[model samples]
Target: MDGRKSLGNHFEGVAARYLTSRGIRILERNVYNRGGEIDLIGQENDTLVFFEVRYRGEGSLATPAESVTFPKQRRLLKAASYYLHRHGLWNCNSRIDVVAISPGTVKKYRVQWIKNAIQAGF
Candidate 1:
């Protein structure tokens, strides 16, 4: 894969491990559908979560979470909606989440989990 994609995949894995450590059960990764791409899909308690993984290295202009803009949120919403519908999960409880990763001073990387970061009806 290209450099950017490779880097993204690496961070997605990082996010996966981080979430798993926190009790989120990952069901899928790198999911592509008609709407857009979902970086990770998992279950947190009874909620089905669609995760958007964002990464920004040092000196980047935007924080990893800030990079998920309005347009991106719309896409994620659509993608998540499609995912829920495709699997007969229209009534399943779900939400879009974000896992923002960046370089850290205290550790190798800083990870932030933002629950329900993207909402529907956008």
Candidate 2:
């Protein structure tokens, strides 16, 4: 795969592991829908989560978390809506999350989880 995709996959893995470690059950990855795609879907505290996984390679310009823009949020919201409708989960409490992964030093990686990073309007 290309570098971007590869990096994203790495972040997804990291995000998944982190979420799992935090007692969140991941339900889906790269969920595609009419609006756009939600990187991850999970359940935490009886709430449905739509996640966006972002990663920045070393020596890059922008911070990993800075990549999620307004347009991206719109797409994510659309995707989340489609997922909820398709799954018949309209009533499920949901929110968007962002998991940012940055290249770490030789010993470890840095992962940041931003919960309720965006909202979906009905």
Candidate 3:
């Protein structure tokens, strides 16, 4: 893979590890289709979460969460819908989540988990 993609995968790993430590069971990663892509798929309690992992290094203007704009949100919703239909998970409760990561001075990285970051059909 290229440098940017490799870095993204690394951050996704970081996000996954962080979430796993907090009791979320990761089911899959890099889930992609014609619609779009989901960085991570995991279970949190009874909720099926579709995570969009975003990472912004130091000096970046926008925070990781801010990078997920309106267009990005629409694409994520489409991808999440495809995922649910493909897995026959229509009856299951699900939500789109954002894992925002950034470099921190004290800690190596700062991680923020935003639940229900995007709603379907929005």
Q: What tens-digit string does per-residue lDDT give for candidate 1 at 1-122?
A: 99999999999999999999999999999999998999999998888999999999989999999999999998999998888888989877898999999999999999999998987842
lDDT of each residue in 2-121, candidate 3, tens digit only: 999999999999999999999999999999997799999999999999999999988899999999999999899999998888889999999999999999878999999999999884
lDDT for each candidate structure? 0.93, 0.85, 0.93
In candidate 3, which residue pairs clash?
none
RMSD for all candidates, in order, please.
Answer: 1.2, 1.7, 1.2
Ten contiguous residues minimizing lDDT sum, candidate 3: 113-122
Candidate 1 yields a Cα-based lDDT of 0.93
Rank all candidate structures by their TM-score, best first, as comma-separated numbers.
1, 3, 2
Off by over 4 Å in 3: none
Model 2 clashing residue pairs (backbone): none
Better of 2 and 3 by lDDT: 3
Task: Give a tens-digit lDDT track for model 2, residues 7-107.
Answer: 67777888999999999999888776677877789999889998899887788888888988888888888888888889899987889889988877764
Residue 90, model 2: lDDT of: 94
Q: Residue 52 of candidate 1: its Cα lDDT? A: 97
Each model's TM-score, in the order given? Answer: 0.97, 0.89, 0.96
Stretches off by above 4 angstroms in model 1 are none
